[model samples]
Target: MFKNKKFECYLLKNRIPGVVLAVLMTVFMLMMAGRFELFNRLDSKTYRTLNEIESISNPYGSDVKITVDRADYLGYDYFVDSERQGSYYICQQDGRYAILLLKSNDDVVLNYTIKGRMISGGSEYSSIIDGITSDMGIAVAQLETRMYPLIISEVDFPRIYYNMMLLVLIVTVLWSVYVIVRCIYEVSCPWKVRSVRDVLGKRADRQTIRDIDSQLRYEMYYDQYGIAITDKYFVCHGMWHTDVVALDNIETFKKLRTSSNIGSGKKKIYKLLMVDVDGVTYEQDFRSEKDINEALSYLSDDKRVKR
Candidate 1:
């Protein structure tokens, strides 16, 4: 029933559109919070130890190739040369090097990163210079009006969970409630049948009882309201009824006194019966016990059946 409950909540979670949405919001969240950014950040944090540094020349290019003491450089090497190189250029900062040459193999090879320990020391360190590639005659400009640094901030919310979507969900819930209540009301009124046989038999067991169950529906309905019965089974809604038992049908009479019993144990073949003023043998296989009893009591002679 609440199949979409978890989904709906998840959509609005994390103050979306920060958590806004993707094809699979759950997948995106589990991925990195903001899509693949989560995994990307984690992988970025994982790096090979800096170890000792070394200098080497590619000899093929005018650039001087700087190597690291370790083997697992994560497939990256640095360059240190002021002259324009054959392919790429690299420079040093905070003990790490940055790459220039927008199309340089060095840029692709060297996995430059922002190290926290590098910046925390003091303002003697520069933010942009601390970034990779900024030292190679390259620079990044920032908005000056912002007094404090915006980096390392977790912000942005509400944009993801929109109001229109919420309104639609509310309307859907209301529709469901209305559907459920209407079904309940339909259930409150137990349906009934008018079996010429159940009330009486070929002999009508008692003709008086037969007349009661045989009463016109409206006449029977008014009297049956507010009645509580536990023993009888209600078949289908009265809008549809079954074939009625004939007034003098012998087989029908035999069916009436079955093993099935209410006030007492008796043999019976259970079937819902219905009555229609416009049809003969109004008794049908789909009547509610309410109607059957109403019809029976309608014809009560002992005055035992009451409105």
Candidate 2:
């Protein structure tokens, strides 16, 4: 199941082995349904055990026989007919006697027909499986004249598995929801919301810049949305940039100044004020993305800005 939203955070990815375990479990399940080579031989005892439930209708009727893929060890070629009864016989590698049948049921929930099959092949294989059924009196391939819907009726009510399944499904859904919600919060909430007044009051800790180095030059590098970090001499216009802006940063102010300057790129430099997009001041003058973040971080935490 794919989600519409991509979990954009940098998380450890597909390289993990968790996916491998999930795949192995899925394959193990398919094999349990007799899909693996080891279980092809369906002896009478096995058939009787499965038949006891009676509620699950093999969408494949008794008429269809399965195409025996392997018959070396199983010792039986098996099949089911139109009426939902099964039959088995020996396998001949020559392929002369191999036949398969399939049937499907119109299950309402899926809006499509679903099917299953019984196989017939391999004489040696058939002998081994049917040999167990010899005294059962009921042919393993004999179709039941009557079919019953799967339901539960105990002294009090129905099978608890049904309720359990519903409960499990609901829990899985809730768990998924919780995971997604947390992921969203983890990704988005740390990016605090800044208001216009918050933006105006925002300032960078100039002390950090001054303390870092004495011979620094300052340049304002900006676009409609971003700033580039370079030592001081202040290029009012940066040549190339591609990113969006966080409103409360000193770098955003720098980009704002750059955009409002006279010439493009290296040609112009000026005193930058707030950027007015649709009559609202949105940006500033500073050097680095770090500076931009400092201002945004301040407003995000400042109760005055929030108010």
Number of the predicted model whose TM-score against the real structure is largest: 1
Q: Which candidate comes out best when scored by lDDT?
A: 2
Models 1 onward score TM values of 0.21, 0.19
Worst 10 residues of 2 by lDDT: 147-156
Tens digit of lDDT per residue, candidate 2, span 126-200?
454355447456574541222121211111122243345445445655555565554444334322212211432
TM-score of 2: 0.19
**Candidate 1 structure quality by residue, lDDT tens digits, 265-288:** 653443322232333232232135
- The 0-to-1 C-alpha lDDT of every candidate, in the order given, reads 0.29, 0.31
Please list the residue runs of candidate 1 whose C-alpha ends up more than 4 Å from where it truly belongs after superposition: 1-129, 132-147, 151-158, 169-272, 277-294, 299-307
